[model samples]
Target: MARILAEISRTFGEYLLLPNLTDERCTPGNIDLSAPLVRHRVGELAPIRVATPLVSAIMGAVSSVELAIALAQAGGISFIHQNQPISEQAGMVAAVKRHKAGFRHNDVNIKPSATLDEADTLFKRTGSDVIVVTDDGNPSGTFLGLITTQDFNFIRHRRDEVVDSRMRTARELVTGAEGMSLAEANSLLWDSRQDVLPVVSADGRVTALVHRRDEALHHKFSNETVDAAKRFRVGAGVNTHDYLERIPALVEAGADVLCLDSSDGYSVWQQNVLAFVRKEYGDAVRIGAGNVVDGRGFRFLADAGADFVKVGIGGGSICITRDQKGIGRGQASALAEVVAERDAYAEETGMYVPLCSDGGIIHDSHMAIALAFGADFLMLGRYFARFDESPTNKVKLAGQVVKEYWGEGSSRARNVARYGQGKDLAFEEGVDGYVPYAGSLYDNVTVTLAKLRSTMISCGAISLRQFHDTARLVQVSQQTFVQNSEEVQRNERPTVA
Candidate 1:
């Protein structure tokens, strides 16, 4: 006999938060968005905590090396997608780990002997206007000279002219040593009135370049997510089939955390994966698991030693699992049940496993609502895919700029291991699509975080923990939901045109 739950499935759209009485101390500035990223005892701190409650999803289109670096600088983390080969994925993780604040170590470079035509091609490939002329044509090669678009005009210079002909030689440039602090480098850059300062090793190899603009940009992110070594924090996704090979590579590459990327994670395969991770790493590594929708599923993963449990199924903007397989739950109902079970488990076992609201975050307000529902953090795919940093290309669609966004289960991704449907996908559970271009991750995330903080302040909460404990919600009827929107529309309607 099949058992059906009594509660009606509900979505975030049907619920609204009721504003609480604001206190003098409940200001937006006082709100702390930090949350634990892993499981821990009630009285102690988790081994990992993110400054912000947002994490980019583990999708090929959303989480890439560039996106990971950008998100980490904005106080969040990104799980580099596992759709590519293990080595490629590992390299992406290594790239983020190698990133230094206010410094560019992987800037475009070319050999001095290369032609201006070759330099132009390199510039277009990297989307950089400036290129370094190195002895070996690599970023770490012996410092030679610097070339910018300003150094030559296509109409004025011949195509075959060598880069060294027009470049500013090392002798003419002001340089910093490898061990110089970012502040010290900035001072030198400003003092020398140079737009760029190359940091060179004792042997005259270029180690990094400090750009004048990056110093200002770096100051805006006071809460950057970084490891003990001060390098940016990054996560990597792994599938069940290749965990044996993938896990070792990612860990060796300095990935801060790992997540099991599966569409459905309440199966024996997930348990086996968790068991293997525990047996081999012995808590030295932090790995999260799941895309489960209910309390039973949450308990299963929690008991299996998942550092954190991911919640939600068939609720992603690109996912169609519910329509295809008829296996899904509403985002709100799923969060409600899983949160209750998480609390109960904490009371019984004294271990508090964090819950991550994985998908269905269509709006910024949804983030506040998820927090009220006790989600320790959020995993966003579409929200991140719209940013310039995402791996996919941006295209002009219907006269509007948009970025490509696709699900792992879509034909475009064909991530069979994530779906666990065998060696290849039997059917599509996701869609390929586009999202409106939302500009830089920093600018968009700034607005989103502002809205979230204001929401928390309106609810009289000064921290995520306080918001979780004190927030109130009301389920709106269909009529009330319509009326709520109509009121705003009515107010904005053009007067008697």
Candidate 2:
């Protein structure tokens, strides 16, 4: 006799689950949310470690350097979109990597002979508070002197004055050597009693700059995510087809993690690409592969040496894969099955692959639901797209402010020159759409995290690990669901006079 598997599937909205167990010993304030949401090696051979589980999905053009910086500061990682020319995408990655650090290697440099008008233009353009005055206006040029905002403020009315006249010469500024450590640099700045310390080479070329206040600010952020260079850790997406050309450029540009972006991960193209990356960069780069739904798919990727696996196929808000192709699985069911497989795979192979739930999150509470179902972290496009930092601008739609959002498989996304395949798309797996504008990313993440913490408290689980082990789902009647929705609406609606 042959065994038959059940044909049942579940999704996030189909039922409600509550934890039956509670430990009075645990409190919400004491809950440690700092566990490694995702653990993978940076390069081919490094030891595994944790990163914030909340990841930003690769939304082309809409994935901005500012958004990446904001997420890294909040202890999460953002994937810079790869739909443009290699250089443009790489530039965005480099910008995020260089944004904030103990030392900024790419700090702005100005020519000593340049005028305040020129410096003002540079300041307005680059947002740098200090500019190093060099012989040739490059970091490798001979160091001449430096100019700070105070220099400009003093000469505010002298709009036509040359930089050399107002700038403080190098002799007056505290200087450090090129190879000095951050601690030594800090000590030098403190001992010299200077706000800015420039590090220069033996031949007098500028190497890097250290700010006493920036160093102080860095120490205050206990949850910041950074790479070996102490730059905010960031990831980028590359399709299986062009990864051969895209991967090298991205890695060189300081991408901390690389995701294999495909609508389907079980195809030969994905496997070939994954194998090629592992072969070429073995253990040198961390790679994640996905869009899988079941145990077999997860097992295949795991065996193929993927550092992490993404779960979800057609569960995205704009995706039509399930409707058009009828070849996708419900996110809830898919995540459950895959999570079990991940646990089993770890037991069998002793290598744990972190799972990322890729899409279909709408409400803040859904984030908690996904984690309870065993997602190590949630990858969001729609949620992140609503923030002011998204690359798209807001427009008024029906009296409400909204931002443009589109899926990678939509015509708007696929018709780009770099990603254009020459042949017309047979059918779109995604659609272009809009989402209501949300405020700053900081406020949004803070509110969501607060709600998540509240959910954890209600579940009596102090950490995601505990929730994964102890949480259970319970089916509720349609009436109960309707009542809850009505209650929320009533609370949100304004009362009539």
Q: Give the TM-score of each candidate.
A: 0.93, 0.77
Off by over 4 Å in 1: 113-121, 127-129, 148-162, 484-497
Most accurate candidate by TM-score? 1
lDDT of 1 by residue, 1-497 (tens): 99988989988877899999898998777889999999999989888898889999999999988788889888899999999999999998998888777777655789999999999888765546688888999877888989998898889999899999999999999999989998899999999898999999999888888889777656765788888877889999988898989899999999989999988889888888889989999898999999899888999999999999999999999999999999989999999999999999999999999999998788898888999999999999999999888888889999999989999999999999899789878999999999999988989988998999899989999999889999999998989967866744345757796
The TM-score, computed over Cα atoms with residue i paired to residue i, of candidate 1 is 0.93
Question: CA shift at 40, candidate 2, in angstroms?
Answer: 6.8
Report RMSD for candidate 2.
5.4
| Candidate 1 structure lDDT | 0.90
lDDT of 2 by residue, 63-92 (tens): 688678768877778899877788898998
Residue 462, candidate 1: C-alpha displacement in angstroms: 0.9
lDDT of 2 at 401: 97
Clashes of each: 0, 7
